[model samples]
Target: MSGMDPSAVPGPTVVDRRRLVFGVLPAAALLAAGCGRSNDDRSDGGRSARPPLALVYNGPQGCPACPETVAALLRGAPRPYRVEYVGGETPLTAAALADARLYVQPGGGADLKGTWRHLEGSAGAIRNWVREGGGFLGLCFGAYLAGRNPGFDLLPGDTNGYIDSPGATVTDGRDTVVPVNWQGRPRHMYFQDGPAFFLDPGADATVLATYPNKTAAVVVAPYGKGRVGVSGPHPEADASWYADKDLSNPDGVHFDLAYELIEATAGRR
Candidate 1:
């Protein structure tokens, strides 16, 4: 990873959590009505009281599989949790995040700048929310958005395409599985135009996984009192996403990696 000059990037805007609470309550209420049904919906014979929510961005900026795949992964978490869709018609407002334990920004198409355009409105809200102890998980394109340039500036460093990194194995944007060392365990995970994180000097970010090139592929860091986790691969991807690609994970479909990320970002691990 390369060192970045922290001064070159704007830092997070400080906001009083108390003021944010009172300001967005009404908007959050209206936004919640349009969110997706919880995994614990009573109509599905699940518990009447919904568990804590994980709000996922399902807007046009994200790929078709991004939102649903992530929601499926969240449903398999160790603890009880609910899934809610945000973005597009349902904007991600401060109120919408009030009750959410986590906010996920999934992989999108290759256009990072375009994705930021759609998400710029919620940038301040997300930054402030995470600072107040809410968790954030970014996957693939989402990880790119966690950087300083064309992103939310959540990380002290910057992000670049993994395909262009030194010693990178997968050199294209095709759908395929690539080699990764996840916490010292060898594994193959779905990859596309993922990102390689470059932390600034002395930044206290934890590297959870690495590309074959040994660049940071997955990392977790502190944002005020909250936590931020970003992955360069698609751990939330399901079998359906691999169809016709002739690709497969020897370990089969699993949510372990995704769950690990959730747990870490939510401060449960």
Candidate 2:
């Protein structure tokens, strides 16, 4: 091993890792020495990196795993993403509702559990945005929020079950797990006030998981020119949510599916 030590590599050596990993790399002659960031293929010639995403969460209901999700995204997201809590704020305030490339909705717990009140005004803009090639993702309540037909009428449907306003308590069956993938497989969800999942004809929703009652646990569909995703379970619930006032019990499968749908639908491009 008298050759160059692997650690001595400098900046801007490899162009694309995929090109190197697959063993189909171009001639080594084209490859530069050392490894680092490059200015080519960048907008400003690498003057600076792309900005982090600004994600807004409407409603007063807070997500326990919100922080974790943001951390995970910042750590691993292909692009940067920032999280913000937007309660009582109009959707039109941000470009996301008007013309975002990808939009993600985190679990707003009870804030979005009302009579579709918060989104009543921005429904049309939301639909238009999706139909215009903007990606939409709904996690737990986020899915429910995106499924609302609102102004666009792109998706027409409603979430089943009835409960009081933000702090109403609904008793759970303790062992009554409405499995997302299949019955008997319990996904831990707590403090939920009867958020039964359902799908309507207008929604054109696809089922990724469900409860024994046949309600759609997870659904995905295309509306107009955009794609929408819904999750009945709270895959965003991380270890903190599980230990604290957890909503849906943290199920590995649910999180994987949520993350997958989120990336597919609302990834920052």
| Candidate that would win on lDDT | 1
- How good is model 2 by TM-score? 0.57
Local accuracy of candidate 2 as per-residue lDDT tens digits, 1-269: 00123343221111121222234433431221221121122232253655444344544433333433533543344443444434345444335554345565654333332324555665666666777766666554454455433212334465533222232233321112234443344454322222344456555656665554555556667766777765555554444433332223444323444456566565333
Poorly placed runs, candidate 1 (over 4 Å): 1-49, 267-269
Error of 1 at 120 (Å): 0.9
Best by TM-score: 1
- Residue-by-residue lDDT tens digits, candidate 1, 1-269: 11113322111111111222234322211110001112333222367776678898987652454566677678766764678889877899999988888999876444455566788899999999999898989887678778765678898687887877888897654556788899989988877657888899899899999998899999999998899999888787666555434568877867788788888888321
Q: After superposition, how far is residue 38 of candidate 1 from its true place, in Å?
A: 12
TM-scores for all predictions: 0.80, 0.57
What's the residue-level lDDT of 245 in candidate 2?
A: 23
